[model samples]
Target: MYSLLGVRKKQIAKMLFYENMTMGLIALVLGIAIGSLFSTLSTELLLNLMGIPMDIHFEIPMNAVINTSIVFSVIILYTSLQGFRLIYRFKLIELFRAEKQGEKAPKNSPILAILGLSMVILGYYFAYNFIDYVEKINFLMLALLILISTVGGTYILFHFFTVFLLRHMRNNKNSFYNGMNVISTSQLLYRIKGNATSLATISTLAAVTICSIGISVSLYSNIEDMTKGVYPYSYTHTVIDANKEAQVDATLEKHKSKHQISHDYLLKTLEVKGTAHENTIKINKTELNENTTITVISQSTFKDFAKEFNYNNVKLNKEETVALTSELSIKIKKQFGDLQESNNTKVTMSDGQNLYTYKIKEEFPYPTKNLFSDTFIVSDEQYEHLKTTSKEEITRIINVENESDSKSLTADLKTIIDNKEMPLYDYYTPYQQGIEGSGMMIFVGAFLGLVFLLAMDQSFILNNYPRQTKINLITQSYIKSELQIKK
Candidate 1:
C-alpha cells in the first residue's frame, strides 16, 4: 500500500527503523534508572546477609555507565537495521494475508520424539550416579555428556514431540471440537514450531535458577557444620613459653563474662615426619613420596579429649593406631576412593635416628587446623617410646560458650600472641569467612534467578503476541462466514 502510494522503499524502512529505535531508547533509559536507584539497597542487603559488619556508600562508576550505553546503543542499531531489512523483504500481499494464512503446523517424526525422551532419561541416570562417577578419571566426560543429553533432549522434545502430540489430539474430532478445545488445539498446533525455541529456553533458565538458589541455600544453611568441621576448638594454639601461656590464661579469665570458658586443656604431642599408606600403594600425597608431618597423641590424652567433647571412645592395642584427618581431606580422598575401611593401612614415623611403624585400625574425623596436617592416636606404651626419641610440642585448646560471637576475644588474643612463636587458630575466622562466602553465593544466585525469571516472562509474552493476534483474526473471519451462510 505504501509503495502504491509512491512512498520510496528507503523512506518506509527509515520510518520503521525510527519507531523501533525510539522504543529501544525508552526501554534503555528506564532500565538504567531502575538499576541505579536500587544499586545501593542491593549492596546493603548482600552485606547484611553475609553477616559482614560494615557500612556501604552509594556511588555509580562512570565507566559502567559508558559501557552500558555503548552496548545498548549497538543493540539498538543492529535491531533497527533488522527492521529496515524486514520492510525490504516483506511483500504487501503476504502482510495482508498473514491473519488468513497463519503459521503452518510443523512436521515431526515418532523416532525423534522417542530419542528425545531416551536422552532425557539417560541424563537423569548420569546425575543420579554422579558421586560414583566423581571417583573415576572420566568424570569431566560424564559431566559433558549430562549437559549435552539434557539440553539437546529438551530442545528436541519441545520442537518435535510437542508438535506431534498436539497434532494427534487434533486428529480426534470429538476431543478437538469439545468446548474451547478447538481453539486451544488449533493455536498450539500452528504456534508450536515457531515458539519451540523460546519454550525450551524458558525451561533451561528455570532449571538454572532453581539449581543456583538450592545450592546456595544449602551451603548457607550448613555454615555452622562446615565451620566446626574445619575449626572444632574455639581457640587452639601452640603456646611454648610459660609466661606467655599464663598471660593468655589471665586474659581469658579477665573476659569471663564475654568469653566464658567451657573447657581448657593442654595437649602434649610428639611431632614427626612419616609416610602413610593404604596397603602397597602410597596414599598421603598427590606425588605420593613426600614426607608428611604427623602429630602423635597418646591414647590417654585422646580418651580425655573424647570425654570432654562427647566423642566416641575407642581402645587401641599397642601396635594398632587411630588416624585423625581433616574433613576436606577426607572428602577429597573419598571422592577418589582412597578413604575406605581397611585393616592393612600403616603409618611409619621417624625421629632423627629411629623409625616406628604402626598399623591403622580406624580413621576419625578431627580438626587439625593449621598446626598439623594429621594426628595419630597410639597406645600409652607406644607413645612413651616415640616421645623418648621425638621432640614434644605443647598446645592449648580452649572452648568458649559462644564461639562465633567471640570476635572481640579473638582480636584481644591475637594482640597478645602477635610477634610471638605461638601459632594461633580460632573459630571466629572460619565462621566469619563461611558466612561471607555463603552469603555472597546466595545473593548472586537470587539476583540471577530474578533476572532469568523476568527474561522468561518477557519471552513468553513476545512469543505469544503474533499467535494470539492471528487466532483472534481467524476467529472473527469464521464468525463472519457463519453469519453470511445463515443469511
Candidate 2:
C-alpha cells in the first residue's frame, strides 16, 4: 500500500488494515478447509500403503487451530499497523520524489576486500584445524570468528571483489565490445554493489540450507550401519560368581528349548597392576597405572573369534600378548605411524611379589562394546597367571536365533537375573540399542532439516521482495517514459 500511494500514512494504514484483514480472513477459512482435506488424504493413503494400523478419524484440534488463527490474525494486523511507521519516518519531500530518486553505485574498496579475504582464510583455518579440539577450546569465540568472517567476507566479495573482477573483464576490448556485454556488465556491477548485503544473505542461506539438508540426510541414512560398528553383540551380561553364571546358563538353556537361543560364549577379564612403555622412534611414551583392566583370552579362543570376523589369526608366545583397542585409540595410533611400527608397547605386570614383562605383538578391533578401557589378548598360560594373581571378571555374550526375539529374550533374561538377586552391572541388546540410537538420529535430523529449509525459503523471499518491487517500478517508469516520447 505504501509503495502504491506514498506520503499518506493515515490513509494507507486504514486501507491496509481493513482490506488486508478481510482478505486474510477469507484466505484463512479456505486454507484450513483445503489443508485439512489434503492432510487427511495423504495420511490415510500413506498409512494404508505402508500396511500400518492407525485409527483414522476426522478430529479437529480446536485449541491449536484457534490459536494459530489468532496468531496469524494478530500478525497481519500488527504488520499493517507497523507499516505506517515506515511512511511517517520518510520526509514528505522524499516521498513525493521517491519515483524520481535513483540508487547510486557503491564505491569499491580494494583494501576492504583484501582484509575480508584474509579474515575468511583465517576463519577457515580455525574451523578446519581447531574442529578436533572444539571441546577443549572456547567454542563461542570460535563460532563468532567464523560468523563474522563469513558475513563480512561474503559482503566484501559481493560488493568489491565481484566489481573488481568484472572491471578487469570489461578492460578486455573483445569481450566488452560484444553485443549487450558492456551494458549488462555495467548494470551487474551497480546491482552487486548496491545489493551486497542482500546477496550475501541469500548466499549464506543457500549454503546453510545445502549443508543442513545434506548432513541430516547422510546421518539419517547411515545411522543403522554406524550403530552396528559401535555395537557388534546381540546381548552381554556380566556375571561375577559361579552361582550367577550357572543361573545365566540355565536361563540360556531354558530359552534354547524354545529355539530362542542361537549361540553364546564367556569372556573373562582380569584387573592387574601394570606399567606400559611404548618404544618407538617417533614417540616414546610410558603409562603407569595400578588399576589397568586387561581382557584375558586363550590363543585358541582368539583364533576362533578371528576366524568369525576374517581377521588374521594371531598366535601369542607364553611371554607375549596382543592388544585390542577401541576405534578411537586405533585412529590415534594411525596418526603417529603404521600400527606395527608404532605399537611396540611393553607391559610389565606385577603380582605384588613377582613381575612379568609381555611384548605386545599386534592390535585388533575391540572384541566387545566396552569402550572405556583397553583389552589384551594373552596366551592360556599368561591368562591363568593373571587370573590367579589378580581379580577376574566374566561376561556372558549371547546371540539370539531370530532378530525379532532379541528384545523379548533380553527382557526375560534380565528378569531371571534380577529375581535371583544377582548384582547385574548392565544388560543390553544391539537390536534395541541400534533402533533407539538410529530413531533419535532420524528424528533430530529430520526436524533440523525441515526447520533450516523453511527458514532459508522465508529468508530468500523476505530479502528479495523489496528489491524486486523496486526493480519492477523502475522498469515500468522507464518503459512508460519511452512510450510517451515515441508518441
Candidate 3:
C-alpha cells in the first residue's frame, strides 16, 4: 500500500483501506475464537493441577471484543491516513531519487567512545550498589538514569567506536586488497553507521523485555517460598478477651476432632502502643516518620515462638530486652551497618515513670499486620509491670499441618468467627497472601512485558524497512543490467 501510494494516490488509499479493514475483521473474528478456546483450556489445566473442581464454561467478554475491534479499526484508519499524508508530502522526483542518494558516512569520535564506556560502567555500578536503598531514593529516577546511560552508551559504541575500529581494519593493505573484502567491509561499515541508533534501541528493548519477564517469572515461581518466610503461620488471630480466646480454642479443637487436622498454635499476651517516644530503642532509624509501634511480649512467649520456629532462643532479664522486627527492618538495618551479632538500645515506655533498656539479641521476620509494628521481648516481671501499667492484648498464631488444608480450615474458622460479634482480627493464609501480593505483581509485569515486546517488534520492522527496500532495488538493478548486457 505504501509503495503504490505515490502512483495512484486516491485509488490506492480507497483500495488499501477496504482490503485492510476486510482482513482486519476476518482476523479479529478468528483471533477471538482461538483466543477464547485457548483461554478456557489453559484455565482448566491450571485448575486441574491445583486440585480444584469447577464447571468448564466457554465465555467470551463482548465488551472486550468490541473495544479491541474498535481500537484496531481506528489504528488502521489513522495509520493509513498517515501513510497517504507521507506519500503526498514527497515530490515525484524525490521519490524516484530516494534510492540513488544514500546517507553520508558519519565521523568517528574517540571521546564519545570513551564517554560511552564510562557511562555504561557507572550506570551498572549504581544499579548494583544502590538497589538495596531503593526505598530511600527516587526509584523511578534511578531506573531512568540507568536506562538512559546504558542505551546512550550502546549507541555511542556502535556509531563511533565500532566504526573507528572497522575503518582501521579497512586501512590494512592485505585485508583491504583481498577479493570482495573491500566491498563487503565498506558496505558493512556504512550500514552500521546509518543504523546504529535503531540497532541500539532494539538491543535495549530486548534486554528490558527479557529482564522484566525473568523477574516476573522468578517472583511467581518463588511466591510460595517467599510467603513462607514472611508468613510461617496459616492463621493468626488477635483475641482481646480471655473468654473469647478460650471459646475460639475450643471451637478449633472441636473442628480438629471432626476432621484429621494437625495444628501448632501459640497464645501470647502482650501490651501494644501505636507510638514510640524519643527514648525508644530506635531500631528503624531510616523511617522518616517518628511514629514507631511498641509491642512488649513475655520472655516465655518469645521462647515458645523460637522453639516452634527453630529460631535461636534468648533469655531476657528485668534490665534487658530483645527485639523482633520484620524482614524489611532487618534489610534497612543491614544497609546502615547497624546489624551486628547483638546491639543494645534504650527504650522508654508510654508511662513516663517506667524506663527500660533493652538489647536486641536477634531479629526475626514477622508479619507486617497493622496490629504490631515492632515487638520487644521482655522478662516475665517486666511483662507483668507493663500489663498492670498498660492495656494488654492477646494474640494467637496457628500453623496448619499441610498447605492444602489451609484454605478449607480458614473458611471454616471465618464462618465460626462471623457468627459472633467480637473484637478479633485474623491474618490471611500464605496462599491468600501469595495471590494478593505476588499474583498482582506477575499480572502487571507480564502486561508491561508484552507491551514492550510488541513495541520492539514493530520498531525493528519500521526502522529496517527503508534499508531493506534500498538493498532490494540495488540487487534488482544489478540483475537487470547483466541481462541487458547478455541480450
lDDT of each: 0.80, 0.63, 0.64
Report the lDDT tens digits of candidate 2 across residue range 376-404.
67677766876777877666666556543
Alpha-carbon runs more than 4 Å astray in model 1: 1-10, 57-63, 97-104, 171-173, 242-257, 279-290, 326-337, 350-356, 366-372, 406-422, 472-487
Estimate, for each residue in 92-186, the C-alpha lDDT of model 3 and write its tens digit.
67878976786677687878877877877877777777756565668898888887788888777778877787788798979986855666677
Across 1-487, the per-residue lDDT of candidate 1 in tens digits comes to: 7877989889999998999899999999898888888988998999898887778888887787789989999999999999899877878777777667768769978888888888888887888788887667387888998999989998998988887788789989999987568998877887788888978888877877787789889989999887777777888888678888788988898789977898787778888667777666653323322246678898888888778777788887777888887676677677778876657688877654556677888777764443236888877877787777677888788899888788888888888775557768888887888889989989988998888778767877886788778668978897888789999
Global Cα lDDT for candidate 2: 0.63
**TM-score of each model, paired residue for residue:** 0.84, 0.73, 0.74
Better of 1 and 3 by lDDT: 1
TM-score of candidate 2 against the unseen true structure: 0.73
Minimal lDDT window, size 10, model 2:
280-289
Residue pairs that clash (backbone atoms under 3 angstroms), model 1: none
Error of 2 at 135 (Å): 13
* Candidate 3 residue-pair clash tally: 0
Q: What's the lDDT for residue 261 in model 2?
A: 55
TM-score (C-alpha) between model 3 and the true structure: 0.74
